[model samples]
Target: MSHRFLAKQWSLIYVRDVLRVLVARDFKLRYKRSVLGIAWSLLVPLAQLAVMYIVFKEILRLTIPHYTSFLLAGILPWIWFQSSLITSSMTIVENRELVKQVGFPIAVLPTVTVLSQMIHFLLALPILAVFLLIDGLRPTLALVALPLVILVQFALTVSLAYIVATLQVKFRDTQYLVGICLLLFSYLTPVFWDFSGIPEPFYSIFMLNPMACLLTAYRAILLHGQLPAAKPLAALAVLSSMVLSSGCIVFLRARDRFVEEL
Candidate 1:
């Protein structure tokens, strides 16, 4: 039993090390030829914020108070979700060499994609903080809830990543379909707009989207300086847990056949 326990512990450590290496490799390859390097993480969101501000505030004439803060809270998280899903969808196919290795943790490919994008999200938060300060939204004890919110979003993204990655292995079109779905989801989610104006069934429908709930929680904590509603947040956590379990099962079962497909 003791020998078995030690072996299990060592296996976990090996997986951890492999995950770390893959994530680092992704980060380097992502920005390797770039001049701005990691600064692109900060800049990309800001650029998106600028476009959103122009479209919503300037063109659509939205009168949202502290609109910059509102937009940043939404855009930063959404970008992380969008980028992770798209990239992870292709991760297994892109790393056919690694997937060919026997006993490899195939799930780590999608996980690495999600985590690397998450780091980008965290890096952009300071910019959001600056905007929040500019808008006079002082830091509150509500800030303490931010990490929990991040963890919930992380779980949700990683779960979806696993599902999409598995699908992409079998169906090459999965990447394009995911891209189109994400495009629709961006508008469906309140990334550039507030859901308050949305009426009954629509509001209820939007809430059904986990990303909608996650974004709402983010806006509440960062912009409004408070915790999100308990019921929805708890529901999201539960839903994410279920999806993750399902995703892992699907990925593991499909993995043995992956080599044949590839």
Candidate 2:
């Protein structure tokens, strides 16, 4: 019955309610202003897929098999991760008023931004299903692995958001740094090209990215109707866990000063 443990449990309660409220508010605000409303979520990812398909499949003459469906599989998760992280970086700054006033727990802010994006992503699944069907893809029991992929993705993203949001709040430059990291990491990841298609040395070097493992699983399930190899998934789980634990430690230390900084 330590006081610290009780305080943390209380904060977790606040976070759960706060996350739901923020998600609902974001859904309302995003669609309320536009005629097409939430359709934009589906459209945006579809447009990105179309452009990549045309550019890579047609223009570059890259003969990737089942390229259309494969791209969507990889890109949707990437878009979710990118969109969430970019928005989460500014979570505290955007809520500066709340930080200054009232005794709201600041840790909830990152979860809020991530949860809002999750709502949009869930709505986009039907659109993904349409394109997936058009590509002659059908459901398989292997699809059960998909949820595991999403769970790992959530763990990874939550950690990154917690760490980066804290840094962004403390040092303004960290915000810009996150943007730059995203730009560079996208190229490094196997979004446009598959490691399997490449020759040895380069493929070996590229597979080192943990996200490449996730991207591979996505393409395998969506295009090939197969499950991810357990080894890579295990590696990612370990790496993500380490990152997440470090993020929590950093957040806990920095959270104490957030109200004063704001």
Candidate 3:
């Protein structure tokens, strides 16, 4: 509720330090009492890949070459997207004491959530690389575009995080709703299956999902060794920018009210 604090620029040097500390604290707290510690980050996605591979590749006998690698590529980014939203959605409410006590930019809370999960996502990438090598898949020159893909995904995730975190401060059920939507979204995304079978107008509609476009790009670079087509890539770039700009607008508008709501 302090006007001066609200007026403070979020780009201040101290704000960067606070963001670093908050991200580290979240990362440590996530694994604090665990037996395997950081290993769990690597294990969780690999385990999910195993079960999904078995069910889809073995039981249903869906034949896609190097299916394990394909699944790994999609699942890693999806996990980051899903977990970031789940945790970030409650960040403001969970840290109400800090919100009331601090005058710093409150937006850092959701940024920290996305960054923390990004660490897990990065850790899981080596596993995907190993799978690619084992499958005799050498990444092409198109692999250089991966950083751009990651940037796009990060923008989208953080934008959604900001919106959800700000809203959940007022409506406590937002987290539950996010969970249900993420569950449904997993099926809608091309995580376990190929997008080629989607067919017609539905395929075009599905491509509009930013996550779908992102996952497709990931598979293109890591699995298929090619860049995503310019059309979808351009669409993703436009969408990410819009989401980021709008999310910042929404979060800043709601930020002043967060303390009272909390």
lDDT of 3 by residue, 30-134 (tens): 889999999999988989998999899989999888999999999999999999999999899988888887665787889899998998998888889999999
Q: Rank the candidates by lDDT, best first.
A: 1, 3, 2
Candidate 1 TM-score to native = 0.94
Q: Per-residue CA lDDT of candidate 1, range 89-159, in tens?
A: 99999999998985677778899999999999988888888999999999889888889989999999999
TM-score of 3: 0.95
Q: Please list the residue runs of candidate 1 whose C-alpha ends up more than 4 Å from where it truly belongs after superposition.
A: 1-10
What lDDT would each prediction earn against the true structure? 0.90, 0.82, 0.89
Candidate 3: regions farther than 4 A off = 1-9
lDDT of 1 at 119: 90
Q: Candidate 1: what lDDT?
A: 0.90
Better of 2 and 3 by lDDT: 3
Model 3: which residue pairs collide? none
